[model samples]
Target chain A: MHAIKTLSLSILLGCFSLPALAEDPADADPWEGFNRAVFSFNDTLDRYALKPAAKSYKAITPDIIETGVSNFFGNLSDVGSMLNNVLQLKGGAAGQDFGRIMFNSTVGLGGIIDVATPMGLPEHNEDFGQTLGYWGMETGPYLVLPLLGPSNIRDGLGLIPDSMVDPVAEVDPIRTRNQLYGLRIIDTRAGLLAAEELLTGDRYTAMRDAYLQRREFLVNDGKVASFDQDQF
Target chain B: MKKSIIALAVAGALTAPMVAQADATLYGSLRIKAQKLEGTSHDNLNVTDNSSRIGIKGSSELFNGATAFFQFEQAVSTDTGAWNGGRLGNLGVKGDFGTAIFGRIWTPYYSFTGAPTDILDNATSASSTYVINAHRASDVIAYVSPDMGGLTLAAAVLPTDKGAADDETLDIKHVAANYAMGGFTAGVSYLGFPAADVDVMSAALSYTAGDFYVATRYENRDAGVNGPTEEDAYEVAGSYTMGNTTLLANFINDDDNVDDVISVEVQQKLGKQARAFAAIIDSNVADGGDGFEVGYRVDF
Candidate 1:
């Protein structure tokens, strides 16, 4: 019975990814030129501005304080994660995610400390882009937004509706909200500092391929059949 | 070519029903753990992503009665949304005689050194202290012989870094063999890094009957290229399952470390693809050194 429920849930969730299922998406980049151009722009901005700012932030901020800032943002994202889990009909996971928010908020000292994980309630990551892909929607075309970097037509469009559900969208005073948004972006980039060294080859192509692969992984909820093989 | 095509057509017609059902698959597990450690050297509480990983794999029958397979698995951190790294990214072909593969995959020695006893999900686990995890190799080729009466042999070779700017050496090799009969199984692996001082040899033995199972592992690292340092470790572990619950315990002894741990874990099935677990570890080297964690694994 439990197996049946899990299978049905996967099937329902799998519906969104069926359109492009057999299409052999090994070379899914149709907008390569435009994407590369935008990617260059994003890269320039990162090299000139964002990366430096992040470095400065890293140098000035103490490690514990930086972790707290990350935890705060993480706690905020849990609201969106809970909503997506509920939408996917994962009631148990949704409940746990909700518990994460409550515990991290109160006992964790307003999300500065993560007190929920040791309690056996784990974090569930979800987003509107993944939700759309869960509904059997085609990933559409590859895209690179001006500042957001790698994305796709479906996920790029998802940002609009997702904002409607974001708690930060409801914050008063546009300046304060903008400042929070800036901090979130910087914090996220800072977290990726070590991983940047792993990137190899053409920056545009590398980022594009990684984004597509990651999106597919998310859409399938980390279940995908191997389609390519290498031999000695 | 025409004759081969005809034969393939005949074979395809014969297996069309099964062929139609063949498909690739993607699967992974997400595990997040919250842990508290109290020791003379450390006292803190934190949440961690405990080896959360995602992977895709599949195999297809070829016309020549061989199967071609591939898999790509990578680690993802749930707490901080980081890409930890890649694992088991390889492709291979299998047939009646044996199987051959290339690309990054688990070293044959890993099964002997870590697979049996590294049951707990985090650094507090015995593996951190007991296992020397040279568990993966890149740009290598490997082969596994067909099982003969419950016995199998495997070997892998990593080539030299000729393209590297440095005068790096190569010819690293790993070999392993395992035999299983009835309620008992045993395996040993030798990893030779002739150019470097990090050669490791390990072995594991296990037995299971009914709902109870136990295993032991040992590993020795030779001193050479890096420094005049040699290290060795041993571990013993056991587990029992009752209904949907499992109880586990493991102890590690290391020659180089001043701290060692003995841990006990309780894991409960939450669903077909989910589990909740709690573990506690006691330290033998430090005064007031102990660690506790509760965690969950959600597989999809």
Candidate 2:
């Protein structure tokens, strides 16, 4: 306990002594003109087609069922997250992901109920893109895919491998796989409805900054040096 | 043909905003805590939701120089998968003449006095320290005057229910005013419950300089039959922020009922909208032992 107290004091002192190292946001969008066009295309599609479907899905689905669907997909994503953690050489996080998968698959009744989080195995969002970033690959230029919305060159390429490992894509029957993919899309979109309020100023800029910041936060494991602390 | 198509798409993209409808922003924070509370007789571990909420708010131009706004916020329970609805559901108009809002909303009294020490993520702060006035009340018509030379005033009335059997209409009224100068702020608030013959008066003073902040509040409750009669409460809290980490401590003494409570917390910011914290609370009241909590919060 004494040693722990001393270590805590040292960390507190170090925190107070550290200097602020703020960095300008490196948006690095050379293809803004083209990206904006594609963003608009995706936005229009989302507003007309996908958004209404997601809204309807949210309206019709019971809360417990919706949560179960989300949890099922989330549990599946952990397989990829675990793989990425291994690739990034993060043994601890990889172990936690493995534990989450095992526990949730069985005790959680195929992840319909997320029993892992309550057990202290927190969720993580990891992919090949973050693995490449951990290995010092640059983000490259920002790009807005035709239907994928915001991404970068590195992440766009990472998507291919990610898709290959995606459990839903591995479903034996093509029809079932396609249906699962559709449900996942709608569920993901519906989950984001509550977050739509954070958008402010230019929609494009806000979306771009938020996406980039979120990517960076995930890549760095939430240790962000350039964060404006006073914004809160 | 591809070049022409690209040019046309760009044109459409640039002009899309002109045809867009007014959008309401949806935002929320999700906070969950795992805690261990040890009392004189029992100890338990539990997972608790700490005021997780989602809200949609928007404003529309009503006329020249006048705008109308509305918000509907609801509480969510992540632990139990239940929703406690209608934390704040209000509609108002804002312009040079000041703002008037009606419906269920935060009371001006609590905003002025209780909010100073309400920094912690759990119930150990405002809920435990200050219990004189309701944090948010329903059926309230509130008006806040525009800032005039660093001073702002607000008042609210909860109209009586004449048709109801209880006839408690116009029973509650609240008034508050705050002043700010440089790094220092001071505020006072009053809540009156005429039918119950109860009244609460509170004052708060706070100062912030760079990463350091300190605040104190004092409250007095007049004689009342329904609750604690002629009670007084005092609270003081301070916090220091260092980069992404903050250290906070607070103490409260309620002259009646709750006794003395003290809490300390450390919070680390994960990003602009996410934080993790660990806190401990110790209460002097009988069987009101010690509680420790660790939690993470994400706001979107």
How many clashes does each candidate structure show, in the order listed?
14, 6
Error of 2 at A137 (Å): 48
True contacts kept of 2: 0.00
lDDT for A221 in candidate 1 is 69
Clashes of 2: 6
Lowest lDDT sum, 10 consecutive residues, model 1 chain B, at B160-169
Chain B TM-scores, listed for every candidate in order, come to: 0.84, 0.87
Enumerate residue pairs that collide in model 2: A197-B25, A197-B26, B159-B170, B160-B169, B160-B170, B161-B169
**What DockQ do you compute for every candidate structure?**
0.02, 0.02
Worst 10 residues of 2 chain A by lDDT: A1-10
On a 0 to 100 scale, what is the lDDT of residue A141 in model 1? Answer: 82
